[model samples]
Target: MITPLIHYIQEHATFPLSETDISLLEEAFIPKKLRKRQFLLQEGEVCKYIAFIVKGATRQYTVDEKGYEHVLNLCIENWWTSDRESFHKETPSIYNIDAWEETELLLLPKANGYYERVNIIPAFNEMRIKLDDNQHMAVQKRLNMAQNYTADYRYEELTKLYPEFLQRFPQHIIASYLGITKETLSRIRHQHLKKAS
Candidate 1:
């Protein structure tokens, strides 16, 4: 399980972790499981771990001052999750991470101190930078899309972003992630389906 993870990271951005590097990572990580709705981190608590999901799904969201819930993101198998601000600065989190289904995860601390001993492959640093850059770009796009795109375009882009979501996640969750009410999502889906037919 861990081997493919290390290999995938190495191949994607040139992390180039040798067998030893991979093994060291495996040694430090702890595996944990959560039943549905279990929380890995909660609002106002310091987020200490960056988790890699090996199975099931999780959602990161927050309740605003008006009591409206805003969906931040959903993570499935082979994805990593945490509040980036909290993870990076070691501060209290503003978001909550809850499992949508029963989940299994591998976790490493943000300041694990393992990176200091294991060589920082230049490629690995680049990979981390690229991930952060891409996430920032995506968030910016999402904010603009919410304000500017029609419900139809938003739905289209939602499919483009998470093509597997319709089949994998529950519909209401998908609607929430798309920043729409379930009825709005239903209307958009109906329109799309009618056009396809």
Candidate 2:
């Protein structure tokens, strides 16, 4: 039942886990699934779990003072998602996490032999390095978008980067993730069509 989980982890990790380490993870990790658009965490709520996506897509987003949503990330299959500030510091979250499609995730308890058990696993440090790398890359990407790109270029980058998203998520959510209004996204799409003609 957990072979998919193990395979996903192994594929993503730079260091390999031993059979015993794999066995220990299967015992310690709690598995779950959420239907499309279900909330995993809401703003002002405590994030109680760290999740690795086993399948499907989820997003972490913030609601503005005017109650408009601004998406931060879209976590696809084999990705990890969480309200990091809340999950790590054990504080109330400033963001909400929800599924974009029917999703499966492995929820690891903060207390569930996390570092202590996984430290013995060869894959542990590899996982940490990747996580850090992803976060750093995300920051650089966002900065580039803010500093150098037009909204249309950003939209194009997104489509190229995550084309599968078009079939799964609504336009407004994608627009928010791109830091543009839906109207702007519509205009951008129109421009793209014109150029392709």
Candidate 3:
């Protein structure tokens, strides 16, 4: 479980982590497991931790007044999920995060100076900076796709970039993530199959 996170840190860190740095990480990250459909954070709760997925899948979403869930993000193994505003500013989150499958996570909590201790490591600090930049770019691209691109184009890009999502998630979830109706997603998939055949 921890090995995956250790590997991720090693891969991302600009410098090699010392033994002490590894020990700090081990101490800081608390391992947690979630059953399928279990909520990690619910709407109106302050998000106290940032979770790194070790295995399984999770989705971050919001419910409308009519109780329809609008998917904001779909995350899987090696992905990080949190409401940044809620976590950093200690505010209530409008979004909910839940596990789509039985999941393992390493949680970095806001309490006890754990985050501060970990960030003090030069290699970890560098990795965090890099991750923030990548996350920013991904958010910008996703916003562009949502605001400007056609649904078909968005679906195509999703297929190209994260084909595993098609296999791992249900059609309704995929449709929600794409901001399309399930019927429209079915139609688009059928059309693609026709073109392929």
What's the TM-score of every candidate structure? 0.89, 0.91, 0.98
Tens-place lDDT digits, model 2, residues 67-147:
899888888877778887787788999999998889998887767556457656767657667777988998798889968
Report the error of model 2 at residue 196, Å.
Answer: 2.7
**What is the lDDT of every predicted structure here?**
0.80, 0.82, 0.94
Instruction: Supply the TM-score for candidate 2.
Output: 0.91
The residue-level lDDT of candidate 3 at 43 comes to 99
Q: Which digits, one per residue and each the tens of the lDDT, describe model 3 over residues 1-197?
A: 67898899889986898899888899999999999999999999999999999999999999999989999999999999999999999999999999999999999999999988988998888888999999999989999999999999999999999999999899999999999999999999999999999
Span of 10 residues, lowest total lDDT, candidate 3:
1-10
How many Å off is the CA of 21 in candidate 2? 0.5
lDDT of 1 at 18: 63
Cα displacement (Å) at residue 8, model 3: 0.2
Model 2 alpha-carbon drift over 4 Å, by segment: none
Q: After superposition, how far is residue 53 of candidate 3 from its true place, in Å?
A: 0.5
